[model samples]
Target: MLKTWQRCTSCCLGNKHKGDFMHIYAIGDLHLSGEPPTKPMEIFGEHWRGHKEKIRQHWLETVKADDTVIICGDISWAMSLEEAAQDLDWLAQLPGRKLLLRGNHDYWWTSLAKMQKRFGEHFEFLQNGCIMVDNIAVCGTRGWLLPSAEAFSAEDEKIYRREAIRLELSLQAAAKQKPAAIIAAFHYPPLFARTEHTAFTNLLHNYGVQHCLYGHLHGENHISAFEGLREGIRYKLVSCDTQGFQLYKII
Candidate 1:
């Protein structure tokens, strides 16, 4: 169950007070495979057995067609775009406009133009870019593992720096729009379990981002993820399992 602070009353179904307000919600690490799931996440835990239905039910109950849902990453298990069609179609049938960030497991992801053309306007992919949601700007990239991680290698450092540049580019683009607020999303946590800060967190702070949402941590690793207010910015982990497969309202 969600704590009181994590719950939003304004976005519930049939709420008369919700007039003209477009709510934004987030959840990530969907790990969906086509209908006959080739990669059942149940192997991770029994809690994932019927996750798709759980997500759909909660989503329908929370999000409206005009609302926006940001999916942080690991959206599908398919190895290629052609193989991911079924999974993509499943998401298309869900309510709300979705903004997707690439996950490490999302090998099916190709160029942004190809994905945009294939999916149309309903699904927007974020990669070194920002999307305007009402007066707010949503910006992000597939953040890599922090250098502080014990397993970090030379190659990991290369990817980490590249992702940092991408994040800066996205933030710069969002800054240009001068939106009322900025929200940064990522597939990997910006900081390590014990580390206080990293390049990713610094970029966020420099850009004056208000909230940061990320996933990728799961099961026993959940305890290590950092959350709550830090340097005036709020960070939250939105992995599907962590949220009990429900969409978290983010204003």
Candidate 2:
């Protein structure tokens, strides 16, 4: 076990010698619409007006080709791969290496193989997977609400367990990469509320993951979103609107 961990540590340290140090950024819930059927986000609230432009400007000003960005999901408003390509086209022009996870509203997200074939390498999709940059490993899944949630049902519980398993798969993948640190991203907040503990949080503890980034909640729902340190892990809500449409610097 120690030898395996050491190998990972060495791999992480070795990655830093590639010229310049890497900068990592994370944000979520982009909710971008595509093509002629563009869906206006302003309907959700005043904050979403021109959200795409806001994200573009912020990304241009903040990230570089050498930097890494994690989009925690709800990326596009498209209903199929064909439409999603337009959004992907715009995202490809942006600077930095990007890892995009899925959100509830991401109907266009299809098979990873199909997406890779279509977008090439413009971005990586995180579904029961992970990515590493220098010493930081990013792992994520579309988390689900716990059984304790007010609206939790038998069906919700079933999906919740599946999501938890996916989260574990992602974390395990990151662990094998042997990163010095782990940052977990989720489309849904891990916990139903700040004070509530769940299987997702337990997994973070088991894996020694130090930070968690998430989105999905918006407007008044932000009040229940978890933030700050809990059980040795730091949680951050990176919803674009919540973070003022700016990328949250993770390192």
Candidate 3:
């Protein structure tokens, strides 16, 4: 059955409630493949074996129908929408409303309209807009690598600036709602390693975002990703592998 909030179709902006949510959870980098798995994640490490089941079990144990889960990105291993059916179906069966953002590896993600039409009833996609979950505003974009990164190219600079503009658009939408708090999600770490801030991080500060969730780093790369409080906003790395395949409660 659809929850009261799910009944509204105005892109999460129309839904309003009197109280706070039961909880808000987040995790990312699902990288799921259909059964008879073509892109096995175990190659990353033995701990990745049976990762799908691990995520399912943890999700079932932690979330309720009333809660929300922000899936930061890298949601599937499929190259196209048709190929992603099985993985999408698997996520659809889980409990709670899911908010998805784009990841660097999400080639299956086409236009927002197509994705929403396919799974909007159970999932909310955050592109160049924001969603109001009760009094808190959920905003995000697929951020790009910082200019400070090694081998940064002119093309990377273009994409980086474009993503920063997209994030600002989402933040502007959220500000109009006058939400009690703002939470930003990203597929890439907004800030580079050993760096204090970037365009993405500065935007969060400008918007008074209380929390920021991100993913993408894995294995040894995880060591360089920054987390914890920075200039008031609490940033967290929620990659599925980093979190032991468990949902990290944000509320």
User: 174 in model 2: Cα distance from truth in Å?
Assistant: 1.7
Descending-lDDT candidate ranking? 1, 3, 2
TM-score of each: 0.91, 0.91, 0.91
Q: After superposition, how far is residue 246 of candidate 2 from its true place, in Å?
A: 0.7
**On a 0 to 100 scale, what is the lDDT of residue 24 in model 2?**
85
Q: lDDT for each of the candidates?
A: 0.87, 0.84, 0.86
* TM-score result, candidate 3: 0.91
Give the Cα-based TM-score of candidate 1 against the true structure: 0.91
For model 3, how does the per-residue alpha-carbon lDDT over 132-170 read when each residue is reduced to its tens digit? 887778999999988879888999999999999999999
Error of 1 at 85 (Å): 0.6
CA displacement after TM-score superposition, residue 108 of candidate 3 (Å): 0.6
Query: Alpha-carbon error at 201 in model 2, in Å?
Result: 0.2
Count of backbone clashes for each model? Answer: 0, 0, 0
Candidate 1 lDDT for residue 7: 24
